[model samples]
Target: MVSEKENAHFSELEKLVESIKQRQQVVIFPPGIASFIAVNILLIASFITFFAPVMTIIGDDWEMSQKAGGQFLVILLAVICIVPPAILITRGKKNLQRWFILLSSALAFMAALMVVVGLTMNNEAIAYQSPPLYVCIITSSLAAFLAQTSHYKTLTLFYYLLHKHE
Candidate 1:
């Protein structure tokens, strides 16, 4: 006992839903592209940081490795951070835009945590004899900044799509 008008209305509703899905595919591009760019920047920074001095012990000719301090840990962490972006760039699902946003936020939080911890660490003695804290601070700060920017932009656009009420 279905009316022709009711059936047509259902058909139209399906089309609207399908159209929104298609548009979402286009909307997800910016965040994914940003992830790709982040991977490249992190890789380059990690390389330069490896050889950079972490600390220089004073008055001691005693041999010490420059790569044995917080910088080493920071560089390793930076490398791990790059892997997520690479995976996202190559295999991100269109339906997982919200998941992408969460991942980005988590990445940003991790980096920001590193920066905060670095700022609060007892670096008075360490700073005199070790590599610059600025390297760890700068590298972590950069990653956090990029991820947060991506999160903000993607979230703004994700919620911008609207359905007509008229």
Candidate 2:
């Protein structure tokens, strides 16, 4: 009953879904490599964001109490968002890749909370600064989401590669 065009469209949709499902496939990698990659990116980004600006502000005679707290907030956000997922991935936790994407979203929400608190309580007009409050929020959210999802994806791929032994 399906028209030729409808059949082709259905076929394309099927392929797309399969591709998404493939994200769940766990492929094997050298031990520690996956975690190393993920953690290094996170740590490097955190260090750059934290010390670089704070040091710059210090060198430029900016108020230490004013900027230090905001920098601390930013680093705290990064750590909270990054560390749990990294630990989960590194430890090879079961179903981590399957569920932690959603789980770490809680950390993302917490990171957002820090930004809001920073803006309100810090008395430094922390919102809408360059890189902006919202952008920082979005960046932290994206990092947390990506870390958990990618770790999950990597685990899935790793499982698929190991399936033959079972």
Candidate 3:
């Protein structure tokens, strides 16, 4: 039912698809290393963010403590977002990197939003002036980006090595 040209075109398409399937079958590394490193950096950043001077109002003074309560809650929220995915990644569950990538991106977004909202509420012009705010935003964003591209990074490395002779 097809012309000779059509038959040759379909054969070329089939070869390309088969090549992709072979590339995918070449799995040399364990999947979680990139995610693990990203999570480690995130954990450290979250710790620093929690203890940063964003809570300047926290003190023996009742009013100051009360005012800082909101800041404390924001830090808690950031930590909560940080910890669960770290736990999930560290637990070594199958296919958890996919979930970790989603969580990492969400954490980055949430942390950035928290920084923006806090800066706006405090009338601060620059997030960089606030250690916790900017650090959380920057580190979470970096970690999310790394987590998302980990697969391609790993695959690209191995693919290069495998085909370098060709």
Candidate 4:
């Protein structure tokens, strides 16, 4: 019951799948890795630039920007590094982890935006102050988030659609 056209289609699908499997060994780069790295660097720089200077300028009463507080940023960055590699190692089709990666990337992007905003502020008296840095941080963050989320969602949806009948 197989026509030539159907057989040709099957052959093409087979070749596509094989090609994908072959390329799976390539080191796939995630879109958000740069953002994560930038965030980490900015966090350290902010601690030094904003916090240290503020402390020296105003003494005990003036606290550092609490936006990049605690080990959360570190943990987030580690996750950013770890998750993509794990997915790449295991291949990116594992549904749960794939979703996790997308969600985590979104969070990190948002955090970076917050940090960028915190850094650009001219206010020394406001808690979580908003400054001109808000513009770049927020704009970049929004762009990063939108691109990663869109790519992730599109890939996930495509995979599900492809396998839906099975």
Model 3: per-residue Cα lDDT over 1-166, one tens digit each: 9799857755664455456557754333555455556565774575456344344434334575675676677667666756665554444333455554565566556656766766778744335445665676677666666666745344333433344344
Model 4 misplaced regions, further than 4 Å: 1-15, 22-90, 94-124, 132-145, 148-166
Task: Write the candidate numbers in order of decreasing lDDT.
Answer: 3, 2, 1, 4
1-166 per-residue lDDT for model 2 (tens digits): 9799857755664454455456854424454355445533644353444344434534456687856766676677656655675565445454545433443345346446656665677734333232533443454455455555544354444434334233
Residue 164 of model 4, lDDT score: 42
Go through the candidates in order and give each one's C-alpha lDDT. 0.45, 0.49, 0.55, 0.43
User: Tens digits of per-residue lDDT for model 4 on 1-166?
Assistant: 9799857855664455555556753323364344334433433333333333333434444345543342345445545644464344234353643444444445445445545544666435432433323433444344335434544443443343334444
- For model 2, name the residue pairs that clash: 25-156, 25-157, 26-156, 26-157, 26-158, 27-157, 27-158, 97-152
User: In model 2, which regions exceed 4 Å deviation?
Assistant: 1-92, 98-104, 118-122, 125-136, 147-151, 160-166
- Give the deviation of candidate 3 from the true structure as CA RMSD: 10.7
Best model number under TM-score: 3
lDDT of 1 by residue, 89-136 (tens): 344222333443444445445434444554578545444423343454
Which runs of model 3 end up more than 4 angstroms from their true locations? 1-35, 50-92, 122-129, 150-166
Clash count list over all predictions: 5, 8, 0, 0
| C-alpha lDDT of residue 78 in model 3 | 60
Question: Pairing residues by index, what is the TM-score of model 4?
Answer: 0.31
